[model samples]
Target chain A: QQPVQSPQAVILREGEDAVINCSSSKALYSVHWYRQKHGEAPVFLMILLKGGEQKGHDKISASFNEKKQQSSLYLTASQLSYSGTYFCGSRKTGANSKLTFGKGITLSVRP
Target chain B: EAGVVQSPRYKIIEKKQPVAFWCNPISGHNTLYWYLQNLGQGPELLIRYENEEAVDDSQLPKDRFSAERLKGVDSTLKIQPAELGDSAVYLCASSATGELFFGEGSRLTVL
Candidate 1:
């Protein structure tokens, strides 16, 4: 089943912060985050494993709560380049694991 | 290294016509996936291949949609007697472990 994302859209000024959350009904072994610019392919952001580790890149970070089957992406001091659609893909524990994605959240960072 | 490669970035066809899209995954990647993305939405998985084996294709519209990843490196997705609702972006991604690398998708417009 597909994951559910909160806040379908968000607009923020430069240097602002935003959070996107993804929740799955089933237990998740891993969560993957991606960002897609308009008319472009989705770019890999980061992956959080079941260990519940928090990962970061630049001003972006994410936390995974395996017990709750939820993940949250954090963008701090957002940049204009941060404008895009964000997606979270979840993988369940088992053989032949496949990534199921959420509908997505649009994030617009303005100058 | 080159990321996933997809051909014919844009295609237009009348309803009832057949359309096909192709993808070549990243070198040495054992997993390939096909996804469909509607405008303003996140990608939905159509099929997933582990090596040459299609481990998960439960989401694919089997009646009119078919896919193959022969030799485990290249893949093709086909839609026969396409309908207007089939217009969407087809995205191809590959992964060695689990973090996917995507290609610029093939956009299909069925009129």
Candidate 2:
């Protein structure tokens, strides 16, 4: 099933912080985050597996809460390069299936 | 050394015409995925191939779209009698174990 993302769009100034949340109705084994600039393919960001784990990039981090069936992405001290669409994908256990994605959140970072 | 490769970075065709996009996945990658992204929207999975076998193609519009990955190295997605709504970016991605690497994508504009 496709996951759900909150705050469809957000505008931030440089050095600001923002959070995007994703929730799935079904249990998820892992969640992956990606970002895509206009006219480009999505780029892999980080992955959070079950067991309430977290993973991150340079200034971006994400946490997965198995009990809540949710994950949240945190962008700290955002940069202009962070302006893009963000998507969260989840893979359920027992299926060995491909990741299902949520509607992306559009983030615009301004100077 | 290289990411997923896609050919014909941009294509323009009239409605009802035929178009095809090709992809070459990373070496030793076992999984290949095709996704479609409409303007201002997130990517939606079209199909997934494990080696040369398509394991998940439920989201594909089989009536107008068809895909094949014959040798487990390269894949092609074709659209016949394309419609105006089919104008979007076609992204090809590959994965070795879990993480995905994306191509620049082929942008198709149907007139």
Candidate 3:
């Protein structure tokens, strides 16, 4: 099943913080985060595996809870370049390389 | 290392026409994926290939869509008799472990 994302959209000022959440009805093996600007590809941010792990990259971070089948992406001190659609993906158990993604959260960062 | 490569960058065609998108995964990566993204939405998996073998294609519309990965290196996604609803961005991604590297994507505009 496809994952669900919250706060469909968010507006943030430069240097502000924002969080996007994703949840699934079924168990998940891993969660991945990606950012996509207009007219561009979705860039990989990071991936959090099962075992309730949390990961950070630069000012962006994400946490995955295998027990709850949920994940949250945190963008700390957001920058103008952070304006984009963020997607959270759940890795299927047998299909290790296949990912099921959410509807996506739109993040707009103002100057 | 270079990222996944896809072409043509964009395509505009009338309804019922045929179109195809090509991709080349990163060297030595055994996993490849094709995802369809509608405007302002997250990408949905269309197919996943593991070294020329399509392991997951349940989401692909078999009636009008087909994909192939030859030599486990390059892949192609084709749409025959395209429909207006088919307009979207087609993203190609590759994975070595869990983190995926995406290509610029091929945008399809069905008129």
Q: Can you give the DockQ of every candidate in the order shown?
A: 0.73, 0.63, 0.75
Q: Could you tell me which 10 consecutive residues in candidate 1 chain A have the lowest summed lDDT? A: A92-101
The model with the greatest lDDT is 1
- Pairs that collide in candidate 1 are none
Model 2, residue B20: displacement in angstroms? Answer: 0.6
User: How would you encode candidate 2's per-residue C-alpha lDDT over A4-105 as one tens digit per residue?
Assistant: 999999999999999999999998989989998887788999888899988878999999999999999999999999999999989997324778889899
lDDT of 1 at B28: 97
Report the Cα lDDT for candidate 3: 0.90
Residue pairs clashing in model 3 are none
Error of 1 at A95 (Å): 8.1
- What local distance difference test score does each model get? 0.93, 0.91, 0.90
The share of true interface contacts that also appear in candidate 1 amounts to: 0.78
Please name the candidate that would achieve the greatest DockQ relative to the true structure. Answer: 3
CAPRI band of model 2? Answer: medium
**Order of candidates by DockQ, top first?**
3, 1, 2
Among all candidates shown, the one with the greatest TM-score: 1
